[model samples]
Target: MSIPPPLQLLLACLAVFSCRHFVASHQESGDWHCDPDDEARIAAEFRPGIVTLDGRADDWSNVDGFEFPLRPALDPDEDHQYKSGKMTVKALHDGKDVYFTLQVDGDYVYSKGDDHKCPSVALMFQIGDSATYHNMGGCKESSNTCNSTNCRGYEVDIMHFSIGNSIPGRLYGGNSVNSVGLVDMYSWNPHCRNIDASAPSGNDSTALNDWKGAWWHSSFSTHPGFIEDDSPYGSSAEKGIYYFEFSRPLRTTDLLQQDAQFSIGKSSKFSAAFWYPSDGNPWHGSAHYTISCDWIPMDVISGLTSQHKAASGNAASLFAFVLSTAAFCVSIFVAYMVSKNKSIPFTPIDDRL
Candidate 1:
């Protein structure tokens, strides 16, 4: 019961067409299937004055970190994970500002004047209620049609750091006088990204990068600071962990709503990305690894402990009780003295009249 030749050819053509359409649709919509771990949450506790923001992980010893395997941002296949190790993310807040530390194990590799050859990292945060982890905020509009007015409620705040132009342990970002590799940015989608308050047409006068960060490696020698002359600061191919420290205000003066405002005891959605030059090859813009296929939950916690609050409450109550007892005693003494000394006042008025 073999099919006829013409019918067979027709059936083959239809199968090929259906396969092509399926592939195209998958690429267009970016159909993502991810089961984010419920326990994988990053907590930014109230740890004021715990870290120095010098890109050193020693100060963050007591802070807890969540580890996630780094997978390709476009294709998250476990077999293609970063060969070195998983990345550890730690965060904390000081009531005024939020801090982050991204630690990834990798061989030291640096190339002066080329950020693509060096390790880099970026953080994307959901700034709008409709924003999503996919497609960088998941704005539907194309580049031409995407703008603040049209693509509202799809903003995601981004902070990117390329260590090639940045000195190890040196501060970058939020400096209007010069441009380091660390930059503050926002995006409606991957194709429509810009500096805060900036656009394709022109730069806004009020635009300011309100981010500060620094980078370091475990192989580097201990030093107060390193200048630009310290190129290739550490030996290449040395096994070590890279540390990227970042900080920004919990809330910014961004009337444009280009920044993510974090609140104490509240949660926010964010994702982290890492770009590494594998085998000495310069990585492209889109070739990077991410923590998860979807956004990760981050909690900004308060500083006060339950025990501390209870102690304060008990002290206040004791003070109030003592003050009330002293007042009662004084009132009773005054009444007794008045009653004993003054009884001739009421009859005098009528007698004189």
Candidate 2:
């Protein structure tokens, strides 16, 4: 009634394989665990009208900050830059609007084709309940075309900000024009942008007109229901650290746009990337940027959570421990079987004796 040695070894191998598969699946899935050290947290202490859209970080000093390291673009051919850095982000929300302050330490490089010096940053958030891969949706395909609007299955709301280049001649200390920045915020929903008439068609002439009546220009004139404010803090001469503040209503009335609306108490997933252009067109130029990884799990509460989410957080450690222990036990069993088999020597035939 006992199992054979070979069979025992086979069973152990299968167990080891299962343990390995479990660990690999979790690692490769790119699922976002609400780890306090790995994932960034955004405090929900914003009050309407309390935060002025100024680039100053004085108001944000008390709030918690999350750090996201910048890396080269996932697609080297489409977009590539070698430079690396980190962006520190802080968030707050009034009942009506949400404000974000991002600070980075890098040289200010203006967009391409522009005469004045400038720099820009962008934030992308996944909209909806479905989970999607974070590498800009380029998981299954061999090519990097997953970034294209047609291949993506989920929608992302983008908040793009630029410093010192929105206006042309408004010089700041004769180096760059103006310190206050501009925001070109929009939603990237392939399903909606392609079908909705109010959404901007995929054409060069109407590209900036993603939303009806919204204009991408140097001035502050914006379309109705479109609310965003931005400002940059840093001297054109020093070019040291730069601080940026962006504010917008939590929910917009523009139903045609692929924007995400938020309630008072809920949770969402967001991913972010930054581009530092080197040459060519700022929008299309070759730039160094970061790879979009797992989502940054955020809670829509009045304050930051004292600890990570109980249900989803700490999964990485717990799962890893279980898998490792299972794998180790299987390995030990296999080794014991092999040793036992070797310890018993073969006996000579009786006729020869």
lDDT of 1 by residue, 133-250 (tens): 8888889998788988888999999887877777899888765533357767788877777766566554454556778998899999858678888788989899999999999999
lDDT of 2 by residue, 219-274 (tens): 22222322222323222233445566666567765343345566667766665555
Tell me how candidate 1 scores on lDDT.
Answer: 0.80
Model 1 regions more than 4 Å off: 1-31, 200-202, 285-287, 305-353
lDDT of 1 at 211: 89
User: How does model 2 fare in lDDT?
Assistant: 0.44
TM per prediction: 0.78, 0.50
Q: What alpha-carbon RMSD in Å does predicted model 2 have with respect to the real structure?
A: 24.5
Off by over 4 Å in 2: 1-37, 47-50, 75-84, 109-117, 131-153, 167-239, 278-286, 303-353
